[model samples]
Target: MSLAFLADYANSDDDSSEHKDIIGGNNISRSEDSNGGQGYCSDKEDVGHGKGWWRGLVCLVIGQNSQLQELASACMDRLCTGTGGAQAAVKPRYVRVLGDLHISLTRPFYLQRHQLSEFARELESSVGGMGPIAVGFGGLSTYTNEQQTRGFVAVDVDHGKESIRRVLDRVNLVVKKFGKRRFYRSPRFHASLLAVKLAGDREMSEIWGSGLANEQERIAQLVAVRIDTVECMLGASKYSVALDRTD
Candidate 1:
């Protein structure tokens, strides 16, 4: 029915640089767990403003700790408002917005801007020789689209998933360009906070399995993302591949 425009620019914000608010906005401070409440919001980097030239290679989901990012951004803003507002053709799709969460780890497809500074200096020397990388977020998953249903939160590359498939095979061998694709032979890493379009197709999966079953059981206890640096959105503006932690 509606895949929300195949992902409405896949979390547009012009590639967000950090406009704040991804959970708790800024006055973040909540305590009291044991399922009582509080477990989300851990933001500090968000930027957006779309322009066009879509690019990819993501990795931003650091240490959730704002009551599970304010209960996964309020359960993806109540499943993007259950799409009852009726899908518009070019706008009014605001179920909620703020940083738009992420954790792609490569799969975006598109490059140009003069080949993006030698593919961002060979992807920052191949992620600084592959160092710091310990992602995890176990639980919750979905990817349907007969009408829409893109909820995500399952990324636990325990053994570092072959070091992120060798940094997505060296970013498809230094981004040759021309709509690249290679990156998902079996890669299932995710972090997308939410997305809904179905109104009858199981009504947003029964409202995300009973309204996010107790915040997905306290977020399936397993949150930890630390991969140094590698943002790159390109087009709306945003590129990074920093790596020098050495710790």
Candidate 2:
């Protein structure tokens, strides 16, 4: 989880003239729009039908901020250009940048319409009193989904790990009561910065080694994040629970 290699790669020029900007016009602002439609209710008719189940996820959302947005833009640019085969391997449509960042407190699950109110109420009661947490980025890292269909580049949480874990513990309790799966037993808390669908079994590291190992300290200093609210997404609906702000 280091970013030292980026320094060298950032300066190298691509020899291929045909190399298109994988990022292209889809820069910072556009990237945010890419995720806008997801996890949101589109049809008015889908609002409240207690007969059906809704797909759900609980997480600590990283709201839009200038600093993190800049870092994410930089990470996306360098990773796509610097990595040898990344530009060609990357599916631009799948890329996710700053605005979509969040740390999952529970795995995606299902909630029946009748259970939504109780679930949200219990979750709020459990974590509402917790104080806001200041979290820092450790460095860059990579992960593949359970099905190994897609790959992700993310920033690991360097500080405030325990506080996040405490919140996760509470979230899991609520999830368990609803008969949903809890999060990982050993979680590596991170905010996914970029996502891609590679052509084959090509590992992201094959595109480039994790990140700039030598530049970790500098990167950590460049990014500072805060978590004060936890959001639960059910279908297109959202429920936000604010943390205690009192010092």
Candidate 3:
């Protein structure tokens, strides 16, 4: 999503200002562990996208090395030879997570097993490590789809007790403006690196009650999305993305 869209998505355009640390205060105390223990931000503080507010915005992908950045873009361009052609190739958004973790952020949304194997090989042979790759199972009940993509909620919440409804509310709110087509018959929530698209019946059943695709329940799940970083750029490129964490 565009920064304009993101600012809106974060509901942070208000002129008011509020600052309260929830976990990591401006001190940004570091630890031997790279996860950087959660910092404090007053839930009441207006630290979203508002001007002058230190909402922990991350833009490392911008103004970095240009040559290595085109990695993903180059791949997409090559894949264009098959179907819609290269011009239609999907542009990848750059992002970096705090701490050294999985480095598989550039994989296509869905992937077949064989492709996943190839991706594993590529990662092992890659130049710089991206971080530990993130892997997950639930597709929703706690997520908002962004630009045909659904990512893990940045909201930080205890998963063992929180119901999935928490995440769904936020996700539904974010995607409400999208056309009906974006709503899948079975909207299973998953932030994919690579996978093949599934056939429709499109039933996405995670927790709660069954029959998701066609059933619209007032049910919702609150998800905690504690964002560590958010990188952005325009045009196409895979290598354009790089992951960096504060020391």
Candidate 4:
């Protein structure tokens, strides 16, 4: 599936120093609060609870350097703006459109510290010799969740499909020990580009059916992405494990 439960990352001024500003040109204000008292917590507190954390494996696509990533982000802006309708006109909560536009490789799952460490070790051994994954943009599609409709720009990974399969196999082996389910049977690989709360669904539907449908092909072919490392998100932190560059 596509991603983004942590999109509005780094909301407070103190935490602002920990994050950088990128596409969409704004720092995501903390949806919670600085102290995290009844609000938000510092990074230390976020992970201290142990149970509140989960891990997600993903390949990075958008960041500070890519020209195409910049373009894709602009497209997101349009999709968000175009979704406004007769509803109360709430402002769209645009994700911080910078830093690693990614596609989830593993469903975010819970794991104890030792379990996560063992998984990391296994992952490192599995692909240390493999090179970068070649991927191409493949148009866009819409997905509906209980509260929102999200727009995903499909990604066509050259040799990475098989890698995704292999990785999932290993991941499922460990995750099952925790009684957690695995990845979607046939996960559509894509980068989540935009999200609109359900209130805007009617409007998003119209835009998707007409104006957007015609543009998918052109937009998808706009660029290619090469991913060289798999990143993991646990709690509020992110860490990377490199993939060897054989190509």
Candidate 5:
């Protein structure tokens, strides 16, 4: 489906903040807070056609765990060191650090300020009965944007695929009510580890062949995470729904 609604708003003069696309999803990015948080605030907070609308981005927060962080660091180091000449081709800025990892539940969309409460309420009610999900990383994979301008290195979801898909279905119902695009069809469900610009198949192959792809089995055994919260971030504010149900 066309995400022109989000694309137009993202490119509009009113909101010019940088976006970091989610892995296996569309051009969804999170705004950084001045206090070093992931909270995003718009430049024209009061200028949604004079209707108080904000670009709403939704996803599940995979908080920084020591194990995951170390895994990311080690993998990056290997990529930079093993790939001899190819390492020089990658810029440091495009690399995703500890705080940038997440699993997106829906593509970005527009939501008015007035609907914030109801949106949060509906989202909470939808998956409140679900307990925490224990997810493990499968293998290292590569993805590029639609324009093929950027490439990403990500770890696909191994265990807990069905549980995550259930959450995606529930979130999409709420997203449709607000007239936003649902999650990608046949989503791969992963946490982006690194992003590079202009890296085509040859370049990606060089990086993968450098030894990162071979480490997948070991990586899967090394990293397993417990996800307990799904967060809804609207412009500068954030709301979280905990997965604490016992039954």
Candidate 6:
């Protein structure tokens, strides 16, 4: 229950102008303002189709400004190199570990960003038992017409593939109870920093228009992250949970 998803957000590029350089354009800088954690999401841009409950997980950053730097470093370390986007768009929340991951008991009447603080508290009180932590991630190449979201996060990990497998197995238990109508799709773990509505009944469209599904699949395969702490959000404020005491 202490699970929270980590968002890799806009690579080194926050502007998002150059499509070709989209690989790692997010700019996350790190500093003394540091904290770390483990966190969720399914494939098909894990954030897909969960707007009613999706409160988004926070990013694990060392510093608010330096958050982008950490992301860049992580990408470069694992990916070798990447990206291009508007430099200014990157912010402490957008470029770093901004919010927590917890489902909202209340749903917004209209399309709007749901607050995360209260839900985070709920997670701490409820699911704080699961631990050791595992995290997985991948970026979007494109989002299909039906996909409601793009992006992935996996957390509360330590063991490796086995650790991830264990969590997924448990998550599947919760997922099985819910019908597709609530999800209207498979359960995917994801984070949303910026969501845009489709203009004038046109329908929402992904900026990349790329293969987000495939991208998420690839990241999950490649990563099985380890974690120590996590954040939860609900009612707009943020909350934290420690993994050390995880059962």
Best model number under TM-score: 2
| Clashing residue pairs in candidate 4 (N, C-alpha, C atoms within 3 angstroms) | 11-30, 36-40, 62-100, 62-101
What order do you get sorting by TM-score, best first? 2, 5, 4, 6, 1, 3
**TM per model?**
0.29, 0.73, 0.18, 0.62, 0.72, 0.35
lDDT of each: 0.42, 0.58, 0.21, 0.44, 0.58, 0.29
Q: What is the Å distance of residue 123 in model 4 from its true position?
A: 2.4
Model 6 is weakest, by summed lDDT over 10 consecutive residues, at: 10-19
Candidate 6 lDDT by residue in tens digits, 1-247: 0111112231110111111211111211111111111123322233323555432433232112233224333422222111222111112232223233322111111112433333334334433445655544454221122332322222222234354344444333333332211222222333232222223333222222222232343344444445544432222223444444532
Write candidate 5's Cα lDDT for 1-247 as tens digits.
1011111111111122344333221212233334322242123442232456666656666766676667667666665555522334445655544354567676656678788667777787777657788888877666655454545566677888998988889999999987887877788777765554544444555554545556655685756788887867665555667776643
Clashes of each: 24, 7, 58, 4, 1, 63
* Candidate 2 Cα misplacement greater than 4 A, ranges: 1-37, 40-51, 83-94, 214-218, 245-247
lDDT of 3 by residue, 1-247 (tens): 1111121121111111223222222212111111121111112231322433222211211122122123222222332332222222222332211121111112112222233223222222231223222222222122222332322112111231122232223223322322111223232322211111112332111211222221122112222232222221111111111222323
- Stretches of model 3 off by over 4 angstroms after superposition: 1-196, 206-227, 237-247
| Superposition error at 194 for model 1 (Å) | 11
Clashing pairs in 5: 40-235
lDDT of 4 by residue, 113-212 (tens): 6555455555555544455666666555554442333333333343357755665565566556557666677766656544444355454444444434
* Clashes in predicted model 4: 4
Between prediction 1 and prediction 4, the one with superior TM-score is 4
lDDT of 2 by residue, 25-137 (tens): 11100111122214322223333335587656677867666665676666566566655224343444545553545776776566787786677777877777587888888
| Candidate 2 similarity to native, TM-score | 0.73
